[model samples]
Target: MNTVEWSDALLLDYEPMDTVHREFVDLLAAAQNASDAALPQTWAAVVAHTVRHFGHEDEWMQRTGFASADNHIMQHRVVLNLLREGLAMAQAGQMDPVREMAGELAAWFAKHTQTLDAALALHMRREPPPVATVHRPRGGRGAHASPG
Candidate 1:
């Protein structure tokens, strides 16, 4: 089961960008399922993907001049750096760092999706939906999975 799942509600309707966001949720689930001994490796992958994901969003924000881009990017930097730090500690044999970090990440994910990301999604939809190939979650609020 996924600890956090991506959905249309979290998207800005920017296909290219939404694809990256969905990948982030998928990666988050993969990291959560990794075993203790394999977690650091999984976390590193997660961290790399997260950086890429944030970068993509930043790029979109820059191109579109989203007013909240600065604030959103700042939040991304803070949370991602924290995840990277936790990964470092876990790699150094701290053992439980990613587990605690998972919970934190999940909380952050939910809040961001419901509030900040939601705003961006709404903004992106103001014009005709973008032409990039993107998939958004279908149906209602619970149509997509969330943290367990």
Candidate 2:
């Protein structure tokens, strides 16, 4: 199982998204590193953070009309559901699966960040290039630069 840590590579270059993602990384790491007695509490925090994090992105995608909004949001739904299932497994004394999920989640997040989140961040930060306007002479006829 691979353990992912917060690094510059994970930064999306967008502060709002980065802030939420940073919290996610911190919370997930806490859960992954928690003691057996503390696992449930820590894991619950992870679930909570994920719900808010994904919801935040969903709103951004909808508001900004991201080209892949449907696909991106669907991925979030799938992962969120999986995380919720992990929570239930933890409640049922299935710490191993929850632990396993932490590693898998970390791995998933790394790739998702690079692809989806990176693109979203770029889109959010993109600015339209300046357009130059050509002014026509008062008359409809084109002005002759030089008389024949």
lDDT of 2 by residue, 62-147 (tens): 87788998999999999999999988888888899999999999999999999999998898888443367777666766655546
C-alpha local distance difference test of each model: 0.78, 0.88
Provide the global lDDT of candidate 1 against the true structure. 0.78
- The residue-by-residue lDDT of candidate 1 on 15-121, one tens digit each, is 66577778877877777877888888888888999888888777777778899999999998998889889888879878576777876787688788778877777
What TM-score goes with each of the models?
0.74, 0.83
Best by TM-score: 2
Candidate 2 residue runs with Cα over 4 Å from true position: 127-148
Candidate 2: give the clashing pairs: none
Candidate 1 lDDT for residue 18 = 72
The regions of model 1 sitting more than 4 angstroms off are 6-13, 127-148
